[model samples]
Target: MSKWFCILLIACASAHAAPGAAPADDAVQVLNDKSLLNQIVELQHNVAEKAQSKLSAVGQNVSQTAYQVADSTAELVISSMGFLGLPYRRGGSSVETGFDCSGFVRAMYQETVGMLLPRRARDQAASTQVIDKKELKPGDLVFFNTMRRAFSHVGIYVGDGKFIHSPRSGSEVRVENMRESYWLKRFDGARRVAGTDAAATPPKNY
Candidate 1:
């Protein structure tokens, strides 16, 4: 009878030990779940950081572009203003002497922005895009056919429907209105050199 009782106690102890051993497998599974959660969190953080970096780069590019446009426009205005009232000489191209229509434009752009426009006014017109009369803005080159050619003369737009130019041999550099009867009738077209933003907003009538 004592031997039978010892055998029954051993069998009960073995059944309890089996359940305790299963906890080891459960602990390993819990650890694996924690590791997966951590990896997912890390991946999400990296994606967010990359997105923010890209946005900041785009913002900086836009800011730089705007600053460049403003600076270029200001330079154009200043350079054109300096040439005001200079005597007009046919085929001339330097401030030390005088300037013709195209020569004045060439010298101004070269001095201010370091860009070389085509020598002749007609060539300058052909080299640039043909912007509409309504799309005119400061820093644009306004062309004319005063000599009965397609683009024999040129000027620099100074906003407010006006442009600065050396009108003739006896005339000095001056600003004239595009809305006037004579200028409006002789208007040939417009041109833009490098560094001038053609996409800039057009000036409105004040």
Candidate 2:
């Protein structure tokens, strides 16, 4: 009888230990799964952060490029303005001496933008791209039929529908408005130089 009671007690203890051991093993497995999920989430976050950083760098590069182009264009226009009021001389081509209508345009382009334009008003118009008046912008060449021929006179377009030009042999360089009856009647057309792109692009060889 004593041997049988001892055996029965050992069997009960073993049964309870088995059930407890199963729950402990399950707990450990759950903990490992949670740790793995956390690691995956952290990895995803890191990848997103790196992608954002790269996009920001590209945005800054584009902004800098746009700024440089605008700065260069503004400088060219301002330099042309400084030559205002210089006396006009027939066939003259330099600021130190004087300038004709075409000479003035050529000198301004050369000095400010490093571009050499054709020497005569007619030739300058023929060499450039013809654009409608509605699409005109500063630095474009504006032509006039002052001598009954297309592009007999040429001028640099300033903003606000105004242009700077050497009017005639006795007149000096001056800003004139296209709205004026005299200019409006004689308006020939607008032209753009070879390197000035209508579309946005990096500065081209002038």
Candidate 3:
């Protein structure tokens, strides 16, 4: 009777021990779940950091471009104003050799703005954007008909309804008002030079 009781106790103990020894697959599954969760959390953190870096870079580029545009415009105005007393040559286009009416306009753009305008005043007008006299701004081109022909003369508008130009053979480069009788009578049109690798491409709002 005592031996039968001992065997029964041992059998009960063995049954409980069998459940405590878990299967290998169950243990592996728990480990895998923890690893996957950790990986997901790390990935999200990296993506957020990269997004912030890209946004910062884009903002810096826009600010730099805006500053460059303002700088170029100011330089163009200063360079044009420097040639106040140069003589007018028939087909001259540089400060070193003087400038013709069209040449003066062309040289100012090339020297200050670093753009080569079309040689003829008429072609220069045609190549650029046509604007009304009322919309004239500094660095814009103003056309005239001094020789009884359209666009026979051209000058650079220098704000305040005034311009700088090389008038004729006997005259020198000078600033004159567009309101003068001779210029006002011959005013054909106004045009702004097209962006040719200078002025940062202006932003167009949608």
Best by TM-score: 1
Where is model 3 more than 4 Å wrong at Cα? Answer: 1-58, 196-206
**Pairs of residues at least 3 apart in sequence or in different chains that clash in candidate 3:** none
Instruction: Quote each prediction's TM-score.
Output: 0.67, 0.64, 0.65
lDDT of 3 at 109: 79
* lDDT computed for candidate 2: 0.63
Model 2, span 23-120: residue lDDT tens: 32322332234332232233234334544554577776554444444444444554554555566789988866778999989987787667899999
Expressed as tens digits, the lDDT of each residue in 1-206 for candidate 3 is 23442343234323322223333232233223433223223323433454455457777565455445444554554355455556667898875577899888887778767788999999999999997666665567889999999999999865556677889997777667688898889999989876522232221110
The residue-level lDDT of candidate 2 at 135 comes to 71
lDDT: the better of candidates 2 and 3 = 2
Which TM-score value belongs to model 1?
0.67
2 or 3, greater by TM-score: 3
Residue-level lDDT of model 1, residues 125-189, one tens digit each, is 88887777787766788988788878988998866677777789887766676889898898887
Q: Predictions ranked by TM-score, top down?
A: 1, 3, 2
Residue ranges of candidate 1 with Cα displaced over 4 Å: 1-62, 198-201
